[model samples]
Every structure is written in C-alpha cells, then in structure tokens.
Target chain A: MTEFLQQLLNGLSLGAIYALIALGYTMVYGVLRFINFAHSDVFMVGAFIGYYLGHHVPESTVWGGLLVLTAAMIGCALLGMLIERLVYRPLRSAPTLNVLITAIGVSLLLEYTGQLVFGAAPRTFPPIFPSANFHLGPLTISSNQLLVISVTLILLFALRFIVMRTKIGTAMRAVSLNPRAASLVGINNDFVISFTFALGSAMAAAGGILYALNYPSIDPLMGVMPGLKAFVAAILGGIGNIPGAALGGLLLGTVETFVGGSEWSTYKDAIAFAILIVILLFRPAGLLGKFTVEKV
Target chain B: MDWPLTQMLTVKNLEVCYGAISALGDVSFSIAAGRIVTLIGANGAGKTTALRTISGLLRAKSGHINFNGEDLTRLPPHQIVARGICHVPEGRMIFSNLSVDENLAMGAYLQRDKARIAQNRDYVFSIFPRLKERLTQAAGTLSGGEQQMLAIGRALMGDPKLLMLDEPSLGIAPKLISTIFEKIVEINRNHGLTILLVEQNARLALEISHEAYVLETGRVVLHGPSPELRTNPELKAAYLGG
Candidate 1:
C-alpha cells in the first residue's frame, strides 16, 4: 500500500505538468480548430525563459521570486502573441493544410532559435522550491511536487471559472462553436483568437516552469516530449474538451507511474496512442465533444 | 430605382464572383428603415450571394455598401455585424455543437448589458416557446422545424434594426414554413424592424414582403411595393409561379 501510495503521488505530480501543457493544445484546438503545433515550442521557450529569468533574480526577497515568475509568463505571452500575428494570422483564410504547414515552420523557427540562445546541452535548474519533502506516515512528497500539484489545481479551476462565468470566456466558446456566426454576433474574432493563444500558451509556460522545479532539468528540446505527451493526453481526454484533458492527464500519469518499468512498461507510449486511435475510430467527436454537422 | 429614399443599407454596382464565374454581377439595391423587403429569384438567381456580400462574408470586387450612412463596402464581417446589421445566412446556419441556450447567448455577442442579455434571452424564449423547451438540448439534436426556429431566434437575440434572412424555409415542413412566415410578419409588426429576406419561393416571399425585388442574373429587373409587384404581369408568370 505504501508503494502504491508513492506511485500515486509521483503520477499525480507528473500529470499536473502534462495537464497544464495539454491545456494549450486543447484550448487552441477548441477555438481555432488548428493544431497550433508551435504550441509545444512555446512550452519549450517558456522553460528557458523561466530558467533565464529565475537565474537573474536575487531570490533572497519574496518580490524577486514573484518577479521572475511574472516576467517569464509575460515573456511567453508576448512570444505566443507574436507567433499568432506572424504565423497563424496570414493562414487564417488558407486551407487547413496550409495553416498546418505554417505551424510546422513556426515550430522549427522557435526550436532552432531556442537552440541558439540556450544551446543544445541540458542544464540543471536551480531549486525554485526548498529541498524539503513532506512525509505522510510512510508516503513522502517533495515540496516542489506539492507546489506543482496545488498550482495546477488552482489554474485548472481558474480556467473553468473563466470559461463558464466570464464574458471573454463566453465569447471564446461562441467563437469556437461557430466562427462566422460568432463574427456575425459582433465578437472580434481576431481579439478572441489571439487571447486564446496567449492564455493557453502562458498556462503551458507555467506548467513548464513548475515541471523544471520538480525535475531540475532544462533544455531547448525538453518541451518536445512533454508537448507531444500533453497533446496525446489532450487527444485521450478528447481534444478540445478542457476538463477532459485534465482527467486524461491524471489518468495517463498514474497509469504510466504504476505501470512503468514493469513488463508492460514498453506499452506505455503505445497504450496512449492505441487509446486515442480506438476512441477516435468510434467517437471521433471526442469524449465530451458533441458532433457537428455542416449546413449548406 | 434611384433609391432616393434615405437608404439604411445601400449596395451600388455590386459585383461578386466565385473564382472565374460571376455568381452575381452589377447588383444594386437599397433598404430603408422600418421596411420589409425581399429578393425573390430562381434557384441560381444569386439571391443568397447578394446577401452574403452585403454581410461582408464574400468580398465585392466592385461596389460600395453604405449601412446606416456608413461605408461598409470594405469593412470586415464582424465589423459589419457590430454596426448593427444581423445576418441569418442560408439554410438555417445554427451552431449545431452548442446548446440552444448557449446558441441564444451568442447572438448577443456585441451587447454589453448583462441585464439586457437576460431580458433578450427571455424575449427569444417567449418568441419561440419550443426553443425554451429545448434550452439545454444540443442544437443539432433539435428537429428540423425547431432548428429553423432556433436559427431565427439566435439572430433575433442580437436585437438588430436590420435583420437579413436567407431561405429560412428551405428544409422546413410546409406547415412550419407558413408558421415561420407568420412569425416573421408578427416579429416585424411587434418589433418594427427592417428586414431583407432572400428566397426561392417567389409566391411566399412576395406575399409577405412589404416591397419586393425580382432578381435575375443578379440584377433587380422589377421592383415596387408588394401590392403592385405582386400583380405585375412579367413577375407573376416568370417568378411568382403563375
């Protein structure tokens, strides 16, 4: 039972990060109906930006740590906005394939540019949280892990509140449901679309920063696995379904931890892929998504 | 034909093409406030195309559109909508993925008044009691007649002075078609709205419209108040299905 408890905590921590990054993928897809492949790179950039900012801060003061966190998020928000204006905006009226190809180009640009600035070598992130672990009888969890989990929970709830109760949230939902109708109803499609990218990408960056604290590893390419994994998680939870992404992430993480290194560990990656394919084949609209039919 | 009356919406020398083929050519029309006007034509008459261009969904290669004394020729779709021109595009284009309630809420996208939105929601539900019954149901799951009602209800939620509808009766049953047309007349009478409706059913459109424009190959060939245009010899046989 102690072993099981330990695995559960580890999986939940990992899942929090996955769920955060996956949100960027899911929200963008929900509104824009585009993959926003550059999203993962944004996550990668967030990590480096956070590391760079956090390093320069005089962490002796509470304000400095807060400043570093804010600056990283703000910087990533700007990066997301720029990508939307330059890369995705032009392809707005183009074919879906053209938009997708442009996404790939933007992704490569960010990754390569990051490689130049941060280098290809992986660096250890300094401890953002105190190196202290909490013991619950036989179960143990690090402060970083607790912080990541709590922050993830707060963010997920905040997102839900925004989407359900706020004006911008309603507009985003409206735009996602029908762009043309949304426009006809007098919502600025452009503003909402850009905001969607910024909000989602910023959350992704937060996830990246938090994950770096837990693992202490930071690299230009670090975002790729988490990005891809989060995407898989999003798809598993039913892409475009916000709550589903979170649930899927936690499930995937728990399943991976308990099952990793076992004889079935080889099936971890395969399992995520297989579940997505099977779910899509039967319920292509996703677990929480409703089917849409085009009218003439 | 000069459109000397103060034009609420003016489209002059409008041209719309769909990649090499001219779907609409040199179309021109004007709509005044507090009027019920309609464009009636054959299946390929470019009736819907004209409405689409006016709403800024399709670009006009050569034309000037003035709405509420403002130039809308080059404005984007959302901007035009923001200017209080609500469009209900062809074939009841309801957001199938959204719930009926959510769909209604979206129609007030530009509105700022929280109280007014609540009032407007109540107003729409009152207009179509059937929609009120299916408030939580996904729009796609609604029956054909209910979907059409939801489409119109959604458009009305915007509370625009000028409402444009395209083929609201396309897929509805014959009884529901009459009911919809009756509702249109009631809405106009009660709300005092100006309407620009497009339809292939010449008989029905002309019967309900205050003034009628008979469009052929994108040009308004015959037009006048409904009483005169309804009895016009050429329009009656060619378009009124005499």
Candidate 2:
C-alpha cells in the first residue's frame, strides 16, 4: 500500500510537469491548426533557464529563486512570442508542411543555440528548497514533489479559469472557431495567435523550472525527451483541449511510475510511445478531448 | 436619408485573391444604417470572398474598407470584430467542441458587459428557444437547423450593429428557412441592426433583402432594390429559379 501511494505522488508530480509542457503544444495547435514541432525545444529552454537562475543566484535568498523563475518564465514567453511572430507568423499563408518544417527549424535553432551558450554537457540542476521529506501514513513524499504537484495544480486551475471565463479566452476560442468570422466581428487573428504562443511558452518555462527541481539535471538537449513525452501527454489528453493536456500528463506519469517502479524502468521511454499509439488507435481525441468538425 | 445615408459600413473596389486565383475583383459596395443588404451570387461568385475580406480573413489585393468612418483595410479579424462588425460565416463556424451556451458566449468576446451578455443570451434564447433547451450540449451534436440558430445566436452575443451572414439558408429544411429569415427580419426591426447577407439562395435572399447586389464570376453584374431585382429578367434567368 505504501509503495503504491509513493508511486502515486511521484506520478502526479511528474504528470504536472508533462501537463504544463503539453499545454504549450495543445494551445499552439488549437490556434494555429498545426503541429508546433519546436514546442519541445521551448520546454528544453525552460529547464536551462531555470538551471541558470537556480545556480547563478545564491541559494540563501528566497526572493532570488522567485525572481529568477518569474524572469525565466517571462523570458521564455517572450522567446515563444518572438518565434511565432518572426517565424510562424510569416508562414501564415504557407502550407501546413512549410509551417511544420519551420517549426523543426526553430527547434534546431533553440537546441543548437543552447548548446553554443550553455555548452554541450548536461549540468546538475540545484534544488530550489531544502531536502525535506515527509511521511504520511504509509506514503513517504518529499517537499520538492509536493511543491511541484501543488504549483502544477494551481497553475492548471488558473489557466482553466482564464480560458473559460475571461474575454481573452473567448477571443482565443472565437479565432480558433472561425478566423474570418472572428475578424468580421473585428477580431485580430494575429493577436490571438501571438497570445497562444506566449501563453504556451510561459507554461513551458514554469514546467522547466519545476522539472529541474524534480529531475535534478539540466542541459540544452534536456527539453527534447520531456517535450516529446509531453506531446504524447497532450495527444493522449486531446490535442486541442486545455484540460485534456493536464489529464493526459497525469495519466502518462502514473503509467511510467508504475512501470518504472517494477523492473520496467529500462523501458520507461518506450512506455510513452506505446500508450500514445494505443490511445491514438482507440481515442484519437484523447480522454477528455472532443471532436471538432471544420466549417467547409 | 443623408447623402452618405449615415453609412455604417462601406467597401470600395475590394479585391481578394487566393494566390493566383482572384476571388473578388474590384468589388465595391456599401451598407446604410439599419438596412438588410444582400449579396446574391452563384457557387463560385465573390459573395463569401467579399465578406471574408471585410472581416479581414482574406487580405484585399486592392481597395478600401471603412467601417463607421474608420479605414479597416489594414486591420485584422478580431480587431474588426472588436469594432462591432460581427460575422456569422458560411457553413456556421460555431466552435464544435464548446458547449452550445459557451459558443454563444464566445460571440461576445470583445464586450466587457457581463450583464448585457447574459441579457443578450436570454434574448437570443427567446428568439431561438431550441438553443435554451440544448445549452449544455456540445455544439457538434446539434442538428443542421439548430447549428444555424447557434451561429446567428453566437453572432448576436457580440452585440454587433452590422451582421454579415454568408449562406444562412444553405443546407437546411425549407420550413426552418422561413423561420430563420423571419427571425432575421424581426432582429433588424426590433434591434435596428444593419445586415449584410450573402447567399446562393437567390429567391430567398431577394425576398428578404431591402436591396440586393448580384455577383457573377467575381464581379457585381447587377444591383437594385430587392423587389425590383426580383423581376429583373437577367437576374431571374441567371440566379433566381427562372
């Protein structure tokens, strides 16, 4: 029972990270109607940025981590917006293939740029807080894991509220529904697209910060695996649904934890791809996702 | 009416192209305040294209679009929507994933008046009571007629002064068509809303419109009062079921 409970915490914490990263993929896909292949790179940059902030700033000051996290999130958000405006926006009229290829190009740029600046090797990510462990009943959990799960839950709820209740959220949905109709109603599609990228990147930045604490490692290439895994989570939850991404992430994490808890740790990565294939075959829209038929 | 007749919306020599294929060519038209102006055409004619251009979905290859005295040729879609020109696009582009109610709420995306939005939703429900019954249902599950109602209802959420509807009567039962068209008239009369309608349903559009523009192969070949155009020999032969 205790072992199962421990795995549950670990799964949820890991799931939280995947959910945030998955959101970036889902949000961009929702608005642009294309696979943002570069989204993984954004997640990678998040970890690197968090690593720098966590390490460069002294560990004693609480404000420093907060400031650094905030700054990194803002920086990554700006990076996302810049990539969209400069790279994706120009190809608005271009074919889907072109956009997909451009995304790959952007991914390469982010990856190589990180390698050049941060060096080729992975760096050990410093802990954000003291190594404190808590045992409740049979389940033993770390403060870091609790912190990750709580923060992830809070951010997810906040995002859901913004998307469902706010004016900006309506605009995003409206633009995605019918760009022309939205515009005729006097909506600026460009603005919505820009917001999509910014919001996605910011989420990725938060994910990066949280992920570093949980994983205790960072590098330019770090985002690649997590990004791909999050993509799986996003697809599993439903590609365009916001809540679906989080749900998918949690499910993915739980599956991995259970698998890794046993002797299947070596096949942890394979588990993600296998689950994704099964989900796609059966429920292509993901567990919480819905099917949207386009207006002809 | 004033010389410009307090023009609520105006488009001059609006040209739109799909890459090498030109969809609308030098398409100049305008709408007065509180009038139903219909643009009637064939399947490939420029009616939808013109609406898309005005809405900023398709950039005009050339020409000017001014709404309420502001040049809108350069602005994007949402900004245009923000300026109160709501478009209920062809094929009813309601968000299929969203709930019927949520889809309606999204129409009022630009407005900050929460009270008014609720009021408008209530009024729209009154106008299309079927929607009220299916508020929680996903929009994709709706019937054809219901989808049409949801599309127009969603547009109403925006509190638009000028509503641009493309192919409102397409792909629905004839019984529902009259009711939908009648509701459009009631909306215009009660709300004093200006409307720009585009349709391939020549007879129906001609019947409902105060004035009409007939397009053929990307150009307005004929224009007149609806009743007069109803009898226009060429329009009858070309578009109306002669």
Candidate maximizing DockQ? 1
Per-residue lDDT over A98-123 for candidate 1, one digit per residue giving the tens place of the 0 to 100 score: 99888888888888888898898999
Worst 10 residues of 2 chain B by lDDT: B1-10
lDDT of 1 by residue, B58-155 (tens): 89989788887778878888888878888987767677767888788888877778898888788777778999889889998998889999988888
Clashing pairs in 1: none
* Model 1 chain A weakest 10-residue run by lDDT: A59-68
The whole-model lDDT of each prediction reads 0.82, 0.84
lDDT of 1 at A31: 86
The residue-by-residue lDDT of candidate 2 on B203-229, one tens digit each, is 988888899988888998888899999
| Residue B138 error, candidate 2, Å | 2.9
DockQ of each: 0.62, 0.51
